[model samples]
Target: MRLHVADHPLVAHKLSVLRDAKTPSPTFRQLVDELVTLLAYEATRDVRTHEVEVVTPVATTTGVKLADPNPIVVPILRAGLGMLEGMTRLVPTAEVGFLGLQRDEETLEAITYANRLPDDLTGRQCFLLDPMLATGNTLVASIDYLLQRGARDVTAVCLIAAPEGLKVVEEFVGDRADVQIVVAAVDERLNEKAYIVPGLGDAGDRLYGIV
Candidate 1:
């Protein structure tokens, strides 16, 4: 799988704030939304489009419009849910889907507790949104499910990732050219519990307040 790490000062600035433990939930949520928007722009660089002719007051002009097969945006709940609005703001035409995946605390294995995606995803370009990529089990499982349903291409967008997770996803995708990962930053490592070290810390908790 290919990887794209956003290389912009503004992105880095916002990420720094997000990383600070002192940032509150309200601020964290806002920053995440902004960060996701920036990453989505980078992640959708190859989103399918087709040439179109438009008639202006002066003359006819040619432009490109998003392709017929609207892209699908799936946000792994519930942390992933925080990124939905930011992603859709950029690709408003994209269809939205949901998947509830969480790691088993004891085993650190991803489990899909809920899924609400189309059965036939043939030719669809899907964007999977999740805030963190630490262990990668959830991402691998999510991609596998989308591929199983016939998704032709998949792009996963995350705010932060660990080296271990990146390696895991790369190995899991193997020679799948259609799969790619877009992240804001690759942190140093994963903690014992499989959390990204020096990460923003439990993105779900930071975004939505403790339950």
Candidate 2:
């Protein structure tokens, strides 16, 4: 497992606004889209590509195009849905999938209530869109599902993460296929209730509403 914290002033600045409790939902949603797009740039740095020849008005040149078995983007339901737009804005050709993983409030365990991904993801590169990485159970479970279905590589894009959660994912994913975590920031800690301390409140709530 590899961890990447985007290092950019714009990312930090937007994250600051996103964290403010006073920000409205409309603005919050827009920022989430922008932030995810910014983070997506870093997350897809190693995305697979193959050489291709293109004939331009000036000359023919060799370039790279997304490899076969086009990358799959899976948003982990609800909150993750908010990230889908931003991700696709960048990788418009990437295939889209959905996974409804609800974490029990009491147990804090991820449960797969729904999924719409291809059963055989052989050689497919998958990208997971989730806003927060607080406890990591959700990500670990999601990754396990993909790996089980033959996806040997995955990249998870989150707006922010907690060290404890990152550590959990790293240790849990040791030597299991290739995995990478890309985030805008790593907050201080997780509060007793398992909420990310100083995080942008509940991402799902902020994006949609208190439902």
Candidate 3:
């Protein structure tokens, strides 16, 4: 698994405001959307495409178009839902899927509460969206489900990640050359309750008010 942390100045500028405790909920949501758009740009770098000949006003030109098997965008529900619009803004034609996963408070393990994805994902490129990569159990489980269904490649986009989460994902996806993780920032560590420290508080709560 390869990890990408956006280094662009604009990304950093928005992220700083997003992390501020004083930022209101409405503004936070907007920032998250904008940040995801920037992150999605890097995440879809390997999206499959095919060359096509198009007739421009002046002459014929060769351009690239997304391949026949449209890319799949799966947002791990609740918090992940916040990222969907931004991702689709980049690849509007991509198919959308949903996977609802929540963490077991006691064990900090991920449990799938809902899944509605295509049965056969062969030749499909999947983009998994989840805001926080705290422990990585949810992301790992989500990726396993996609790979099991024959997804050709998988990329996960997150707003923030913890070192512990990154390690777990890297180890869990060992030897999987086609998997990649794109995150805005990798925080210091995970707190006892399994939240990234110095990280933006619960993403779901911040985006939709404490639930």
Candidate 4:
């Protein structure tokens, strides 16, 4: 698995506000949308495209267009939902799918409750939207799930990640398939309770509030 940490002044600035415990939900949501859009630019750098010939006002020219079996964007439920709009804003024509996987706080395991995706994703390029990558269990499970469905290429877009979690993902993914992780920042560590230390607290809660 390859990891890419977005390097940009704008990305850094917005992320600082997002890390603030004092930031309100309304503003938090807005920043997430904007930040994700920026990150989406990097995440989709190698997105599949094919050449096409088009007629312009001046003359005919060749250009690239998104390839067939349009890339699928699957935002893990709840917190991941917060990132959907931003991702789609960048790839408006990409197909949208949903996967509901909640982390079991007690065991820190990912449990799949719902999913809307193609049965056979043999050649599909999938992008997963999830805000945090703390323990990496959820992402590992999600990636495995996609691979089981025959998706050989998968990219996960996250706002923040922990080194431990990235290590877990890398260990689990070795030589299996093509996978990439794109994140805004990699925080210090994961605390005892499995929360990222010196990191933004509970992205789902910050994004949508507690139920």
Candidate 5:
């Protein structure tokens, strides 16, 4: 598994505002979209592409296009939904899928409530979207699900991540498959409630109001 923590200044600027408690929900949502787009740009760096022939008025030339099996974007529902627009804006032709998993607060286990993805993802590069990475149980389960369907590779995009979550994902995926994480920031740590310290609060609540 590989981890890439975005270090751009614009990412920091937007993330700082997103973390402010006084930022209204409207502003918070907007920042999340902007920040996710920035992170998405970095996340898709390894997406498969193929060279193709193209014709110009002056001459014929070669260009690169998304690979044959085309990547799939799977947003982990609710909070992850908030990131969809930003990601799709950058990859307009990519297929979209949905996976709904909620953590059991008492057990810290992730339970699948819904799945709208292809039953077989063999040789498909999959991108998983989830805003905050705290305990990482949910992300681990999500990746496992994709692997079960024979996904070729999986990359998770997150706004903020706690070290604990990174460790858990790394250990769980040791030499297992091509797994990676692209995050805007790796915050200090998680609090007692398993929330990313200095995170943008509960992403779902901030984006859609407490539910």
Candidate 6:
């Protein structure tokens, strides 16, 4: 498993505001979108492409276009839904899917309650969207779900991550398939309640009002 922490000033600027408790919900939501767009740009850096020749009025040139079996964007719902628009904004032609998983507060385990993805993902490049990587159980489960359906290449895009969470993913995926995590930042650690420390609290509650 590979980890990429975005290192741009814009990412840092927006994320600093996102960490503030006083930022209103409206501003928070806007920043999430903008920040994800930046992260998405980095996440899709190695997205599959194919070359083709194009003719201009004066000459012909070779260029690249998204390959067949276009990449699929799967946003882990409901908090993950907040990231969908930002990802699609950058890859408008990519197909969209959803996986709904919630963590058991007591056990810190992830349970899947919904799935709206293709039955077979044999050659597809999947991008999983989830804002926080705290305990990492939810992400591990999500990656397992994708692999079950034959997905070999999976990239998870998160707004922020905890070192503990990253280690959990790395250990679980050792020498397995191709897995990468792209995040705006990897904060200090996970708190007792499994929240990323010095982190923006509950992404779902902040994006939408408490639910």
Across residues 1-211, which tens digit of lDDT does each residue of candidate 1 receive?
Answer: 8999999999999999999999999999999999999999999999999999999999999999999889999999999999999999999999999999999999988999999999999999999999999999999999999988998599999999999999999999987648989999999999888889999889999999889
Q: Rate the local accuracy (lDDT) of all candidates.
A: 0.94, 0.94, 0.92, 0.95, 0.92, 0.96
Q: Report how far residue 100 has shifted in candidate 6, in Å.
A: 0.3
Off by over 4 Å in 3: none
lDDT of 4 by residue, 1-211 (tens): 9999999999999999999999999999999999999999999999999999999999999999999889999999989999999999999999998999999999999999999988888899999999999999999999998999999999999999999999999999999999999999999999999998778999999999988
Model 4 RMSD to the real structure? 0.7
What residue runs in model 6 are displaced by over 4 Å at the alpha carbon? none
Please report how far candidate 5 places residue 47 from its true position, in Å.
Answer: 1.0
RMSD of 6: 0.8
Q: TM-score for all predictions?
A: 0.98, 0.98, 0.97, 0.98, 0.97, 0.98
Report the C-alpha lDDT of model 2 over 54-104, residue by residue, as the tens digit. 999999999999998799999999999999999999999999999999888
lDDT of 2 at 82: 95
Tens digit per residue, CA lDDT, model 6, 1-211: 9999999999999999999999999999999999999999999999999999999898999989999899999999899988999999999999999999999999999999999999999999999999999999999999999999999999999999999999999999998899999999999998888999999999999999896
lDDT tens digits by residue: candidate 3, 1-211:
8999999999999989988999999999999999999999999998888999999999999999999889999999999999999999999999999999999999989999999999999888899999999998999899999988987589999998999998998898888638899998888999888888999888899999976
Q: In model 1, where do residues sit more than 4 Å from their true spots?
A: none
What are the per-residue Cα lDDT tens digits for candidate 5 across 123-198?
9989999998999999999999999999859999999999999999999999889998999989999988898887
Q: After superposition, how far is residue 197 of candidate 2 from its true place, in Å?
A: 1.1
Pairs that collide in candidate 1 are none
Candidate 4 deviant stretches above 4 angstroms: none
Of 2 and 4, the candidate ranking higher by lDDT: 4
- Model 2 residue 133 lDDT score: 98
